[model samples]
Structure formats: C-alpha cells, structure tokens
Target: MNNILTLAAIYRQSLFYFAIRAMTILEPQTKLSRNWHQKAIAYQLMQCFLGLCRRLIINQPPKTLKTHLVSISYVAWLLMHDPSLRIAIICYDEALASTQLRKIRQLLRSKWYMALAPATRIRKDKDTETLFETTAGGEVRALSVQGGITGHGFDVIIIDDPQKASLAHSETERRHLEELYASAIANRWRNPAKGVLIVVMQRLHVDDFTAYLLRLRKDTVHLNIPAVAPVDMTFHLDDDEVYRFREGELLEPERLSDVVLEELRTAQGEVHFQAQYMQAPVKTGGCPINPAWFRTYTELPKYDYRIISIDPAFTENGGDFSAALVCDVVGDDVYLVHGEQVQCDYPNLLRWIETLDKTWKPDLFLIEAIGAGKGIWGLLRERDFHHVGTIETHNGLPKLRRMEIVSPMIEAGRVFVPANAEWARQFLRLIGSFPYGPSDDWPDALSQLLIRLRDACMRAGQHRCRRFPPDPPPQQTSLRYGMHYRKYWL
Candidate 1:
C-alpha cells in the first residue's frame, strides 16, 4: 500500500513519469526513447494543465510525439487530476480528432490508468468514438476546424495542427482559420479567464495559424523546439533544472540522427524542411533565391546598358507598396544600383518614378502594365519620358515561375547588389523570403528587369546570354518595344 501511494505521488508530481508509464500501457511491445526534449514538452504541458500558463503554443518537428504528449497523455492526466474538468481536442480534420480522442479513451480505460486515477471512471452511457465523459462530469470532446461546435463549451481546448501543410499556401484557407478562431473557437472557452488553450503544430508558412495567434495574443508562451539547434541555448525547465543544447545539436540525435535529417532535407525541398524542421518559414536558407548567390559590389563598373523596373501598388492605403529598382547590365552581370518601395498616391508615385528616371538616366524604363502601372505609364509618356515602356501582361506565368526563370542569373554569380545600402539589405530579405515573405514587390520588379535583360540579349543574337529558360509562347497581343512592350520571341 505504501509503494502504491508513492508511485501515485510520483505520477502526480511528474508529467514525464506519467507519460512514460502511459506509453508503456499504450505500446507494450515498442521500446521507449528517452530524451530531454520530451521532458521539456511534458513540463510545458504540465504548466498548461496547472493553469500556470493559460495560452501555450508548441512548435516542433513532426514525429516528435507532440500528439502523444499533448493530445493523448495530457488529456488523460488532466482527467486524473480533476475528474470534473471538461476538455476538447481539435485537429486538422474530423478523422484525426476522433483518432486522438480514441487514444485518450484507451488510456482512461487501461487497468494501469484505472489503478492510478480511481476516481475518474468513464461513463458507459455517453461513450463514443469522438467523445466520452467521466462519471464526475468531466468530458473529452473531439472537434475539427471545419466542424461546428456551436453549443459546446470546454474548460480546456487543445488544437493540434489546425491547418494541413499541403493547404498552407492557400490564403483563403488561412483566412478562414483566422476567422473561425475569432468568431467561434475562441469564444467556446467555458471560463474566459481561466480556460487554457494549447496549440501544437509544425510551422508551415510565414503567415500560418501559429503566426496569426502569436500576432493576436501577446501573452502566448511559444515553445519553438527545432529538430536541430540553430545556436547554443539554455532552457530553464524548473528552478533547479536547465536543459542546454549546443549549436548544430540535434533535438534527439538517437532517434533523428544527422544522417536521417540530411536525407529528409534532400527529399523535402529546403523551404519545406526549414519550415517544418527548423520552424523558420522565411529564413534565407530555405528560399530558392539564396542570399549567398548574390555578389555585392562596393565600386561601380562601367555599365553597357541601364534600365529602371517598377512594380506599382493600386493605392496608397493598400497593403502593397510601389517598388522600383535601378538595374545596370554590364556584359553578363546585372547590378542592382538602387531600390526603393513607398506607400504613396499617384502624384507622389509619379514624382518618385520621375525622380528615379532623372537620377539613373537609364536607357529604358520598364513598368508592369497593371493596377497603378497603367496610370504611371500614361503620366510618364505625357511628361515626354520616351524611353518608358510597359511590361506586357498575359504572360500566363505566376510570380513564383517568373522568379524561377531569373534565378539562374543569380545562381551563375551574375547578379550584384550594393554592398552597404540599407535598401539593399531590405531587397535581399524581400527576395530571399520570396513567396513566403510579406511583400513580393521588390522580387517582382527585379524579375521583370532580369527577364527584360534576358529577352534583349537573346534578341540581339547573343547565344551566351541565353542561359535562362525560354519565354512562354506568345499570347494574342504582340506590340512594339517603345509603345506597348512585349517579351521578345524568336
């Protein structure tokens, strides 16, 4: 009886202990892999259960037992401590939610768990695959982000991977999730002030649901544990305990060795690996346009040709800004001499364009013939800027494809940016972040300039400069270079 009581005491005190025992009960044949990262996760979950932290966000790599620690063991442990505490488990889909809830139900029904939490008995009358209630009024419910929880309320809400990784790029899906949280899920808390909300998932996109929550709530305790440590760091687990990881250290080297991680990185592109494994969606290491590929120039060389490219926003009050880049092409090398983005009205935009044209005295001015570009083109033409031309629409290629077309120029060590300019730093960041980054105006302008340069070189019968992929087949519209400019076709 004394040993039984001591075991119970240890289980109650340490979530790590409880988890290990529960894992044994759940997977009797499988051997357990012990790691400090697991202990760190368990500690954070314990803090959430104890109400020490009401809002918790856990971002980690896949297959790290995030679901086991958070959705399964944590739910069972919560019921053990307080039989009357209501809980809800949310997942990306209904099937996933049901599976997680079923696991928790299995734990609650296990003989080992019964011996530990004698008071928490599952009520047979209300038992289902997705939901089950304890006799003491405590209930566990499974919900999906798409499913309705109109009348349901819970003391604790655990959302596991609210969005699927495949659908992470869909702005519509992302917006729907944000709206759902604001309108529904957030308000379902039984106790507004006391209810705990825990979100656990791998990072998918720069503006994913995790990012949304972080932006919305200031007090959220974000525990971002990357698969490999990017730098040496120390984590305070408790007053007496701290876990330290050296730079380039694996989170769990035994389970996920350096060899395995490299294979995964190769199989999955750098962008996916960085977001899912490193928890860095917009890091330059993941981007197709690598920062290392760009050569920085301190002194300008005599340029054979100079041109200014512009990507304009529709309105001053809009999210996007009017971006312009002054690019100088000397033989095979394209140098980014100057770049700027600003939120301004048409008059201001026109003035900015005129200023850039006057300052650079480029041979040609290329403006994307969309939104504010059309107005800017008309205004520039009226101002007697004869060198100006509009970049023809109807390319049928997306922004990403356009960037990909010009990436070869950058990778070939032919692209240059000013070494010490502040705008250059911002330009590199914008391009490096690419499709995941907040703004693609700079990338757009840069790609346009590169495309134009490539097309001009090809037209001039310079086969050496034809390194990039051929332009897409021409559409219905073909116009003169100075009037309504279109990409030159062979």
Candidate 2:
C-alpha cells in the first residue's frame, strides 16, 4: 500500500543501490553447489542480489540475454542427463513453451556441445511404434498440452508453460493443476528416490504447483524479476488501473488505488487483467462472500438444529457429485450436522432419503428438483410424507433464485458456515467458481433450501386459514346412543 509513484521515484533514485541491497542477501562460496545450476528462475533472480553481501566491493555489468539463455540451457542439459529427473519449463502459454523448446534445440545444435549431439536423425516414440533414440542415445520429445497427452515413467519431464484452455484467471484450470499434483503429476514420483522435479514459471498463483513445491520441497528455488525491476520498484501499478483480478496486474498499483477501488464496477471489465498484472490479493476481490459477515452474524450454538439438503445429478457420466449436507443451526450460526449420499437411481435414492428422514430426525427436509426433482417429489408424496410427520418434506427452491438471495446475505454478514466439513470445503470451491462448472451442483442445493425457508416466512400470514389441517380421526359411537345399531344387531 505504499505510495507507488513515490516508490517508483525512489526506485529510480537508487535502482543500483536496491539491486545491491538485493544481492547482499546471498553469500557466495568460492565454488557454488553443482546442482544449483538446475534450480528454477526465481532462485537465479535471488542470486543477483546475493552479490551485495560480499565484504569486498565489486561491480558487474548489467545482465544480458546470453546470461539468461546460458543459465536455462545449462539447467536443461543437466535435467536431460539426470535419470528420473522431472523438469517443468512452463511458460505463460504454449507458444512460449514451444519458443523455449526451440531455444533448447538451438543449444543442442551448438558446436560447443558436439560431444553430446546425436549421430543421425532421432526417431519419435509413440504407441509402441519403432523405438527411436537420440543420435547420442538421448531422447527428445514434445507434447502439446491441448492434446491432453500424458506420459509415464518420464526420465525427464520437460514442461514449458504447459498452459491451455484459457490461462491467467481460470479457476477450473487452476483446479486441474491441483488434481495433477495430487493424482497425476505427483504420482510420477512413485519411488523414494524417483526423481528431482523442477518448475520454471512466473508467479502466476500463490496456490499453483510451483507454490506447492515451494512449501513442500526442501531443495526448492525460485527467481522472479519483472521487466522494470532494475529501474523501478512499484514498477507495475499505474493510475489508469483501478481493479485487479490477475497476478500481473497486482504487480503495479497507482498511488490512488485505495480511494478508487472502493468505488468501481470493474467486475465485468479489466478487473481480471489488472489482478494478474498487479498481484493484488485474489482472496479479497474474487470471494463471493466476506469473512466479516460470517463472523458477525454467526451465532449458532455448537451442533444445534439439523439441516438436510440434497443435490441430485441426473446421470453418472455427467461428472458431478450428487451430495447432501446436514447442517446444525445454533442461535445464528451454522455447523455441518451430517451427510447422506447415493450413487444410483430414483428408487434406491428415495429409500436412502427415507432412511435419513428416520435417522437424523431433520426438522425440515429439502430435496433438490433440478433433474429428477418432480419424480422424487411424487415418490415422497406417495410415501405419505406429512407436514406434521416426524420430519417435514419440502420442495427445493430454484437454484438461480436461491443464489441471488443468499449470495448477498453471505456478503452482508447474515450467514455463517462451518469450514471443517468435506461438504463445506467442496461447497466453497464450487461457490468460488459460481455458475462456472458442474461442482456448483452442491452449493446450489444449499442456497435453494435457505431461500425457500425465507419465502415460507413471508407466506406465514396467509397460511393459517388456507392450510388444511390433518383430518381428525373418525368419532367413536357409543351403544347408549339412540340408534344403538351395533348392540341390537348382535
């Protein structure tokens, strides 16, 4: 939040001094670690500042293109030679990766490394086709990320910015990256000493694969240098930029952003671009609801009232989780109470619901009608679901209408949600994407249930007279009555 213009001016005043300050952090050894050559870009950027730490004063010329290419080529070569070493050279886009690959080819083609060059044409390997080897017995391969190609047991995993299907501000793509870490990419390291993994990319995310490595790996390294870092510090932020929605945008901010950001509809416009460039906190801008609202309004006593809401996806291949959440409502806050799930069709799912009705003793039961909603409602009616029964059964609220009402309540501090439940976490991820993907199915159900409850309160005044109370049991006739038909006939 510093005055960016002033910081820029100060940066201009002593960029050399700042670079000197940056270099002072890393102490150099007469001989650097051999494997250090293979560290990622951000780690290399950190080295420029480390030189400042030296007791003797020494100045080096400004870094050049050759310096960067040489560092990259040096690392690429080691990664290729090292067996089971996983290397990722991710660029901002496929074009960037391809361009970097060409750079690698150039390095290999260089006469200096003639000893390592292949003897003849290298054969491409795929689908048990005739095996091809590098001229020097090495292997070179490339795959377009958009092709959705996957390789296993990779001696070296060279990925240059393997970005596809709309990079930058895509939460879906980000989620895919997380899954790749948990299921696909991380699974590659099946052995204890399987391989060394390296990721080279700009700081696109704080939760990216790179960030994941930064947190988990002991040998992780990073290098991040903006185009204007040498001459300016608040180098990215400028006056025209008002809202930020991406990393690049957050890097630069105008002096008056605080005053301006408080009042703008940048939601549909350049908000995404600015966020990327400036690196503004995505948590604040992208969240559908504010934490303060939940904090202030949340007064639910621990595990109080049970709330049961369901999500019903029509088909299995739809790639969705048909979920149910049981929430406990206390004074004003909410807690996850219980959950029910079924993967099959209507009859079984209905039986599952009936069992839940019996077990949880839910005060109210909400069933989502997005897919087989009508049939489900009919089945429940046929099963003799009574309003006064142990648990009341109600139709689900419309998903869109529900979101419209509940979203603001969430933002205004009138709603509270538990964070511990698997359902809640899933709900948050889907809500973060809003109407973007299939995962939204679960949150849609919860939102609809709450909205229907609100509408029920509105109809309270008109309900009493029109509401047909459950019929009274048939009256008993006494033999003493005038007719006395039962006794006389006997």
How many angstroms is residue 333 displaced in model 2 relative to the true structure, after the best TM-score fit? Answer: 46
Query: How many pairs of residues in model 2 come into backbone collision?
Result: 54
Q: For model 1, how many clashes?
A: 0
- Mark the 10 consecutive residues where model 1 has the least summed lDDT: 476-485
My TM-score estimates for the predictions, one after another, are 0.61, 0.33
Superposed by TM-score, candidate 2 places the C-alpha of residue 274 at a distance from the truth, in angstroms, of 6.4
Highest-scoring model, lDDT: 1
CA displacement after TM-score superposition, residue 378 of candidate 2 (Å) = 35
Per-candidate clash tally: 0, 54
